[model samples]
Target: MVGERKQEKDVKREKVRGAQDKGRKTERKGQKSKRTECADFTDKPRIFPAEVIAGKPVDISCTFDTTCNGTAPVLTWDTPTDVSGSISNTVTQHGVTLTYTSVLTLTASLKHHGQTLTCRVRYPSVSSERTLILTVQYAPQDLSMTSLDMINASLINIIEGNSTVIICSVKSFPASNLTWRHLNVPMNRTSSNNELWLVIPHVTSRDTGDYECVAENEHGAVEGSITITVEHAPRNLSMTSLDMINASWINIIEGNSTVIICSVESFPVSNLTWRHLNVTMNRTRSNNELWLVIPHVTSRDTGDYECVAENEHGAVEGSITITVELIICCVESFPASNLTWRHLNVSMNRTCSSNELWLVIPHVTSRDTGDYVCVAENEHGAVEGSITIIVEHTPQNLSMTSIDMINASWINIIEGNPTVIICSVKSFPVSNLMWQHLNVPMNRTSSNNELWLVIPHVTSRDTGDYECVAENEHGAVEGSITITVEHAPRNLSMTFLDMINSSSVNIIEGNSAVIICSVASFPASNLTWRHLNVTMNRTSSNNELWLVIPHVTSSDTGDYECAAENDHGAVEWSITITVECRDSSEWTAGLLTAGIMLNLFVAGILTFVYVRKSKTATEERVAEISDIELSPSPLTVKHQGKQNMLLTDPRNTTREGETSAPQGSL
Candidate 1:
C-alpha cells in the first residue's frame, strides 16, 4: 500500500505540470489574436465636415476601439509645418473593449488647405491611424487684372470698332463666383477658375468708362478695376454766328463786335481752333466749344473764317463768310464855291460844292454818288476829309431813237438792211434800260444810260411796236414807237393795148395807141410817165398806175419811161413806141432786111483772115528747116564767129570768110 501511494503522488505531480504548460500556451495565443485585430477609430477616420476654410478655427476628433488590456493608449496627430495645434486624448471602456479619443484644435489657413491631417492611436501591440484631407474655403486674395488682347496695359485704350478683353486673377481656396461691371452696370463676361474676363466687342466712344471685375465666394468677395478709353476722331464740326441772320454768313458794320462759336461733337474731347486766311486765329477753347471774339471789327477783317477740330483720330473743319460793311456819315450841301470837293481825283463844280464843309446835295444824282474828299487849303498845309455818298432816284423820259430821224411815235425802215435802235432814259440816278419788241424783252448792248439794239437783217417778223423801258429802285418808265418796214417795187412791166401779138403798138398816123404800166410795191408808189425826158401826168391807185396818150404821133415814137417812187426809193422801166404810116410799110420791111445782110458780111471777113494767118505760119516753119540743112559748114562757122564777136564787143564786125549783111536781114 505504501508503494501504490508513492506512484499516485508522482502522477499527480505530472498532471499539475501538464496543466500549467497548457495555461501558458493559451495566454500566448490570446496575445497574438489581440495584435491581429483592427485598431481603427470607432468614428470614421476622417474630419467631421469634409471641408475646412483657410484662416478659420476648426475642431478635428478621432476615436479608436481598443482591446481589453487594462493599459492606456497614446494618441498623436501629424500636421503640416505651417499648422500648430493641441491634441488631447480620452479613454473609455465597454466590457472587455476600450475606446480611445483624440481631439485637435487649430486655426486653418491657405497653407493647410488641400493637405492631409493624420491622427494615430498607439497601443502595446499595434497603432491605429486616421487621415483627414483639409478642404479650406477662403475668400479671393491678391486680385489683379491681365489683358488678353492688344489692350495689354494698366489703362486699356482701344480704337473704335476694335475688340479687347481683360481678365481678373485671384487666389482662393475654392472656385469663386466671378462678375464684370462697367460704370456700375453689369458687363458681359466669361469666367474661369480664379479668373474672370470682361469682353468689349466693337468698342466705341460710347463704351469708354470705368470697368470692374469682381470675384466672390462664400467666404468673401474681391474686385479689380481697369479704365477703358475709346479713342475717336472729331466729327459734326460746325461754326455759327451770334450776331447774324444767316448761320454761315454775317454782315456787321465796321467797329462793331461779333462772336463766332465753333462746336464739335466727339468723345475724348477734341481740340478746337479758329482760322482766317489759312492762318490760325486767337481763340479760347472750353470742352468742345471754341470762341473767336472780334472786339473791334474793321474792313480788313472781312474774309472767310474756318473752325477746325482735331483729335488723335483725324481732323475736321467748317467755314463761315464774314462781311464788314462800311460805316457812313451823312453830309448835306448847297451850291457854293467856298468848299472844294473832289470825287475819284476829279474836281467838282460849284453846283455840286457848298460853303458847308460837309457836302449836302439837293438833288442826288448818280454823278454825285461816289467817295468824295473835301479839302480846306491854308498857307501852312491842306486838311482833308472823306465821305461815301449814295444817291437814289426814279427813271424819267425813257425814249427810243432810230437811225432815221422820224416822228417819236412812228418810223419807216427798209427790209433786209441792218437797223439800229437806241434806248435812253433821263434820271437823277442812272437807270437800267432795256429794249422790247412787241412787249417781249430784246437783247441789247448796254451802257450806263443807253441800250443799243441792232437787227443785222430785218425781216417782216421784226416789224412791230418797239418799247424802251427804264427801271430804277423807285419805279420804271417805258416809251413805245411803231416801226413800218417798206419793200421796194418788184416785177415792173409795161404792156401795149390794142396789140395782142406784139409788145410794140402799131396804128395808122394820127390814130390813138394806149399803154399800161404795172408794178408790185408795199406802199402804193406814185407812178408817172416820162416822154423824151419830160414827165407826163398819170393816175395811180394802190399798186396800179395808168398812163394815157390821147393821139399817137411821131413824137410818141421816142422812148417812154414808167417811173414809180415812194418813201423807200424809186424804180423805173422803159419801152419804145412805133407810130406806123400805112403808105411806107413796105419800105420799112426792106430797110430791116438790108441791116441783117450787113451784119453777115462783116462776120465772113473775120473768118477768112483767121485761116490765111494759120496757113502762112506752117509754110514759114518748113522753109526755115530746109535752109538749115542746105547751109555750108564754112558759112556756119563764119556766122558763129561773127555772132560771138558782136556779143563780146558791141560794134558789128565780120570774120575772115563772112560778109556783113543789111540791118534788117534775118
Candidate 2:
C-alpha cells in the first residue's frame, strides 16, 4: 500500500511538470478575417478538452502563438476557489510562430466542474487570454448531463464571411456514440476524448439557426443545442434628402426650415445618435435613424454635424458629416462635385436645385450691393466665378456742410479766404452727385458718395444757399447749406452836393454845406461820420453819414471823415471843408446898386430888408436867412445855427436894419 501511494504521488508530480518535459510541438495557426481574397491571421490564446473524471489528476495547458522573435512571453493562470494548482510556463518556436504555453495541474471534482480556469499570457508586444470550462466527468448514475458553458450557444453572433469555433463536451464516461447535427443533418466535426469542435470556416445567413450535439451511451442519451445568428456590422451609413438622394455633406439656408436625415443598414438595427464635435445629442430619433430639423435656422446654426450608428456583437461605427452654409448658392457643374458660394471669401446660406446655388438677398437695402464669388470644386482642384450685383435704390443719408463746419446748416467764410463745401450721399449704381447755387447748377467734381464745391476766394457771389443733389435711377435726394460770405467795407464815398468822392468844400461865411458818405459790404456795413478824424455815432441800417455844416466859418475849415465798417474790415473818406471871406469891392458895388434899387425899395426892399431874428432846431438842414437893414455906422449880422456863430466887420457882412451892403473901402 505504501508503494501504491508513492506511485500515486509520482503521477501527481508528473502531471505538475512543465510542458517542455514532454516535447516541443508546433503551434496551431489562428483564424483570420477576409478583406478581399487574402485573410490575415489573428494571434490569440486557446484551451481544449474541458472534461475529466473524479479522483483523476489532470494536466491542463493553454497555448498562445505570436511571431517568433528574440523576446520571450510571460504566462499566468487563475483557477477556481479552493482548487490549488501548480502552474508553469513553456515556450516553443516552430518556423515563424512562437508558442507560449501555461499548464495548471489539479485534482478534478464535481464541486469545481462548473467553475472556470483562465490562462493569460503577455508578450513583449501584446497580451492575450483563453478560458476553459472545467467539467468533471461523473460515473453514469442515470446518464445525467453537466453544463459545458464554453459552448453555451443560446445565440451566437458571427460576422458574415468570417470563421468561428463551437465546442461540444460531455461530463459522462464510456460514451457509445457522439455526433453533431445542423437541423438533424450531419456536419464535419473534430473529436477528442468525448469532446468535439465544430469549425465553420466561413459563415453566411444560411448557416444560422440551431446546431445540436447528441451524446449516446448504453444507459441513456443526452443532447445539447447551439443557435448561431450570423450577422454583419453596420454598413452603408449615409444621409439623404427627402427625394432619397445620397449626400456626404449638406448646405442649408439661414432663417429657413431644413432637415438632415441619416440612415444605416445592419442585420440588427443599431442605436443612432447625432453629434457635433465630441458631445452626444438627444435629437429626433426613429429606430436607428434620426432627423435634425431647424425650423428657423439662424447664423449660429452654421457648423459641422455628424450622425453615428452603432450596435453590439461587434460594435461598428457609421458616420455621416454635414456642413451648414449662409445665404449663397451655386449650380451648373459637371462631374457631380460639391459647390460653394462666397461673399468676400465667406460662405453663406443658399437655396439649391440639382444643387443649383444662388445668393439670395431678401428685402434688399442699399447696403446689399457688392461683388460675390462662387466656387465649384472636387478633389483635383477648384474653379471660381464671380458676379457683381448692384441693388438700385434711392439715394439716402444725404447731408451738406463745409469741411470746417460740423453739421452746421450755415457757415461764415471770410471774403478772399479759401473754403470748401462738401455733400455726403449713399446709393447703389453709383449715385450722381451735383451742387447748385441759388437753384442754379454749378460745375462740380464728385465721387459716387461725396461731392466737393471749392471756393478758392470767397465773394458775395458765393454767399447764397448752396444745394447738394444726390440722385440715382430709383430716386433723388437733396441737402442745402447757406454760405454767408463776409467782406470788408468797400466803395466808400459821399453823395451830398454832387460830391461823389472825398474833396474840399468852399463855403462863404454864414452859408450852409452838405456832404454824405455811402459804402457797400456784406452784413450791411455801419456808416459813421467823423469830425476831424473823430468817430461819430454808428448805425447798421443807415449807411449814409451826413456832413452838414450850418453857418460855416473859418474855424470850421477842417477834414471831415466818413467811415464805413463791419466785422470783416473798415474804410474811410475825408472831406476838407474851407470857409472864405467876401471882398469889400463887392460891398461898394452892392452900395452903388442899392442907390438904383432905392426907388424900388419902397415897393420890395422894405419887405426884404426888415429887422428879424430867428433860431433853428434841425441839425442836418440849412438855417433860413432873414432880411438886414442899412445903417450909417458899421453894423454886424447875427445868425443862429447848430455851430457857434462867427462875427465879422460890418463892411464885410450883412447886419440887421441894413437896407443895403455896408459902405466900406476894399
Considering every candidate listed, which one attains the maximal lDDT?
1
Which is the leading candidate under TM-score?
Answer: 1
- The global Cα lDDT (0 to 1) of model 1 is 0.62
Task: Output the lDDT of residue 90, model 2.
Answer: 85
Candidate 1, residues 211-282: lDDT per residue as tens digits?
888888778888877888777888888777745547787765456578888899776677788889989886
lDDT digits (tens) for residues 1-666 of candidate 2: 233344345445544442433333222324322112212323446664434666677887777665544456678887877886687788887655567787888887767755767777765556666566666655433322223323333667777898887766775555435677997898854333466667778887788788887766554567777678767666677776532113554443344456777777766667777776667755433366777666766666655667777666444444444333333444455554466667666786433323456455533333434566767765556667766544444555566566655234666677888997777765544567888886778865434878878888877677656767766544566656666666787878765442434486766555555565767666667788778567655567444555556456788877777788888788987877777777776756644654454345343423332321011111112222121121222211112111222111222121211223222211
Instruction: Provide the clashing-pair count of each candidate structure.
Output: 10, 16
Candidate 2: where is the Cα deviation over 4 Å?
A: 1-390, 404-407, 438-447, 498-502, 506-514, 523-527, 533-536, 540-543, 548-554, 566-568, 579-666
Least accurate 10 contiguous residues by lDDT in model 1: 629-638
The runs of at least 3 residues in candidate 1 whose Cα sits more than 4 Å from the true structure, single-residue gaps closed, are 1-50, 68-71, 123-128, 148-154, 189-193, 244-246, 265-272, 282-289, 327-666
Report every candidate's CA lDDT: 0.62, 0.58
Question: Can you give the TM-score per candidate against the true fold?
Answer: 0.42, 0.30
lDDT of 2: 0.58
TM-score of 2: 0.30
